[model samples]
Structure formats: structure tokens, C-alpha cells
Target: MTAYNKEEIIHQLESHQLWIDTLGKEGNKLGFDEVDFCNIDIDLIKYPLDQAYLTACTFDGMNLYGKDMHSSLICSSTFITTNLENADFYKADVSYVDFTNANVKNARYAKSDCSEAIFIKADLTNAKLISCSLYLTDFREATLKNVDVSSSSFKGVLLKGAKLSGIKGLEDAFIKSINIGTPEIPILIEGEEAVQWIINNCSTDEQI
Candidate 1:
């Protein structure tokens, strides 16, 4: 695991900003491989974090709207109360990330590995999670309205208190098991039964 001091990280961020300004003509694009950014202030890091390795980073209360993070390795990261609206995370490795209370509306996460992630109270309205791995992910109290999760694996996912109105593509997803209802008395459904339960209980007339 590589480590960078605050000044070094800021310098890299400046270079990356220059690269973004010059459209990849002058400065080199920033790419952190196996870097541990724990406790580091990443507010200076520029947008479009493409192809960077950000495993186990913490991004609390940062405004990261419309950032392109495609193919980035951001596994085990924490994004509490962060703004990720319209962010693109296509093919990113986001496994075990904590997104508690984050604003993740309209985020694109196609083909991402989001297994075992926590999205408690996060607003994921209109988000695209197509063809992703969501095994054991916890969406407790998350607002998933109009979200598309087609062709995803939902084995052992938790949906307690999650609002799933107008959510799409559950029929196409592979739902092996899911936990719903309160934690004290959790209700576990499996196979086609879980699919039907989600559709019947969570959907409304305005479904998409």
C-alpha cells in the first residue's frame, strides 16, 4: 500500500487539475495505485477520477457532483453525507463502501462491483446500477425511487425501510435472497418470492 503526505497529494491534485485544464496535453493524468487515503483531506482532488486506485479512502461531506470515476478502484471507501449526484462510476470497484446519508441521485454505476456496500439513508433516486454485483449490500432506509438495477446480482441484500417506488429492472436482476422489514424481526425472502415481494410491496402506479 502506497502512502502520500498531504503536500504530495495536493501537488498531485494540482497536476491533475492542470491535466484537466489542458485536456491531457500538458500535465500527466493522476493515477494512484494501491494508495491508502484514510484521514487525508481529499477535497483538493479534482473531478473525473478516472482509472485511479482509491481503495479505502474516506470522503465525508465532499461535493463530488458530475465526476467521472469510471474504472476506478474505490473499494472499502467511506462517503458519508457526500454529494455524488450525476457522478459516473462505470465499471468501478466499489465493494464494501459506506455511503451513509449521501446524496447519490442520478449516479451511474453500470457494471460496478458494489458488493457488501452500505447505503443507509442514502438517496439514490434515478441512479443506474445495471449489471452490477450487489451481493450482501445493505440499502436500509435508502430512497431508491426510479433506480434501474437491471441484470444485477442481489443475493443477500438488505432492503429494510428502503423506498423502492418506481424502481426498474428488478425482474431482470438475479435475486437469490433479501432481508426486509425491521432489524429486530427481519423478514427474509428468497428466489422468485423475493422478486414478487419487492414488486408488490414497493411499487406504485407510477412505476417505470
Candidate 2:
């Protein structure tokens, strides 16, 4: 039982506000057990983590509020300027994670996979992400206010100047901006003939 020391996780993150006043109410909070701790990169701006696993870690300027991080894997992690508000990370795997300038507001990430992640300028305001897949991810200028993004599978992704205000399933969501703009003007609220049959047969090609 001698594994926790990055100065004991920055002295339990200065003794409060450390993952919601200690492990978000101590319902299985990990102060240190990142797969039995053999140094899995725990600096995070000199440490203050919660329910940590932090696989392949790098985390800069860390705070990590309300952390649970169930089923942690966190492959190829980075997460610069991290705070991770309301963190849960359920079904976590998080492949190729970068999450630059991270906040992850209201984070849950239920059924998380996050393949090829990058999330530059991340906030993810009101994030839930139920049944997540996020394939080929790299949410440039990410905000995603009131996010729900249901039954997701966004292949070859890159939402340039991303907004999509208050998303809900988004049908068969697969946007590289449908090939460099000028074709995304469908909001009729009654399926406008199934969104013009996906603008006359989908797959406009964002890039190979």
C-alpha cells in the first residue's frame, strides 16, 4: 500500500476542491491507483487530480473537478490547462487524447471512446455525449453548447468553425463540413424531405 506520491498528489490537491471536496463524495475515489502506480505521468501543473487513472498522461495546469473517470484508459493523453468540470468519463478509453486548453464543462462522456481525439481550444460546454463514438475526432475551436450528440458516429470529423447549436442526434452525423462549406442550410424542423435526402445522396467527401 505504498504507491501514491507525486508529493501525495500535490498533498491531496491542497486539501479541498480536490475532485469535489474529496472524490466527489468518496464513492470510490482514487487518490492514487493508476493501475498500481508506476509513474503514469502525474504532474498536471504540480498535481491536484481526482479519481485519477491518467493512462499515458501529460496534463498541464490541472484541477480535474468532480472526477470519477470510470473504466479509465486515457490513451496517449495530453489535456493542457485542464480543469475537467463535472468529470465522469464513463466507459473511458479516450484514444489519442490531446484536449488542448481543456475545461470539459459538465463532462460525462457516457460510453466514451473518442478515437483520434484532439479538441483544440476545448470547453465542451454542458457536455454529456451519450452513446459516444466520435470517430476520427478533432473538434477545432470546440464549444458545443448544451451538447447531447446522441447515437454518435461522426466519421472523418473536423467541424470547422463548429457551432451546431443544441445538437440532437443530427440524423446520420458525418461532417467534414460536407466538403468545405456552402451546402449546410437545412433547418426546416419537419425533416424537409429528410433534409433533401441528405442534400441529394450524402458523402460529399471532406477528405480521405
Candidate 3:
């Protein structure tokens, strides 16, 4: 990934002000439908980047603490090893994004579409994903302590090798479409039973 300095980020914002809104914009302002942030590590923690369209960007090892990205479109971005602690992605479209080994503790992804996103070995402790779309998302070997996925869509989701201790809202989550790799676990389960399965089996067994 390319290392982006502050000057480049400023230039991109200025050149693409019509398309890119560095901070949240007011009424009658136009921002880029999608910002090209490929292979750049830009620190966006200080700015509120809501309603941005940033596809195919690489944010590897960037620190994005407590940033607000509500209603943004960020498909196919790479956030590998990035620190996204307490970041708010409410109702964002983050399809096909890669968040492997990223620190997403206390992050909020409520009502977001995260289809086909990769979270392998990512630290997602206490994250909130209520009513989010997670179709075909991969969370293998990820830490999910106290994460909330209640009422979320989990069709074809990968939970193998995932550490799911104290995770909440699994009972209410739709898990009929999960890919656990083995048929030993029941194909269909209610909310309470699913939580029990995570606690009893996922904690003790090697799901890979």
C-alpha cells in the first residue's frame, strides 16, 4: 500500500471538493460519488467522514479512532491491521472490504451492509452490528467478545476458528445460512440455542 502524507490528502480533497467532502458537508454541496483512495494510509480520526464514497482504497495500518461514517459507501476497501476502535459505521455499505487483523473494538456497524467482508483474526471486541447484512462475510479466527449481531443477516457467514466468547444477540440473529464447515452443529437454531452453541462448542472446539 502507498503511504499517503497530509499534503496528498489535502490535495485530493481540494481537487475533488466537488466530488469529495473531506468533512461532513452542508446542504446544496456536492461530494464525489466515490473517492479513489487506493493503497493510501490516511488518518481520518480527526474528521467526520459521513456519506463518503470510497471504494477500492487501501487503509492498511491506519488509525481511525472514533470516526463517524454514517450512511457512507466504502465497498472493496482494505483495512488490514488498521485501528478502528470506537468507529461508527452506521448504515454504511462496506461490501467486499478486508479488515483482517484490524482493531475494531467498540465499533458500531448497525444496519450496515457488510456482505463478503473479511475479518480474519480481527479484534472486534464489544462491537455492535445490530440488524446488519453479513452475507458471505468471513470472520474466521477473529476475536468477537461481547459483539452484538442481533437480528442481523448471516447467510453463508464463516465462523470457523472464530473466538466468540460472551457474544450477544446470536440467539436473535439469523444463522440458518451459516457455513460452519461441519454438520455436527445444528443447521437451524433459535437465539438462545445459538448462544449456547457458541459458548459450549465454539469455545472448546477447533472449528477450522
Candidate RMSDs in Å, in order, are 4.1, 12.4, 4.9
Q: lDDT per prediction?
A: 0.83, 0.59, 0.74
lDDT by residue for model 1 (12-72), tens: 7677767878887876677665555546766643644776667777777888888788988
The per-residue C-alpha lDDT of model 2 at residue 44 equals 44
Tens-digit lDDT track of model 2 for 11-65? 5555534445655654334333233232445534343343355665555556767
Report clashes for each candidate as comma-separated counts: 0, 0, 4
Question: Which prediction has the highest TM-score against the true structure?
Answer: 1
TM-score of each: 0.82, 0.29, 0.76
User: Which residue pairs in model 2 clash with each other?
Assistant: none
The Cα RMSD of model 3 versus the native structure comes to 4.9
Q: Model 3, 1-208: lDDT tens per residue?
A: 3445667565555444434443434222213333434344444554446666667676677778777777888888888998889989999998999999999999999999999899999988999989999887888788888899899987767777788777688778876566655235524443445446665754523443
Maximum-lDDT candidate: 1
Which of candidates 1 and 3 reaches a greater TM-score? 1
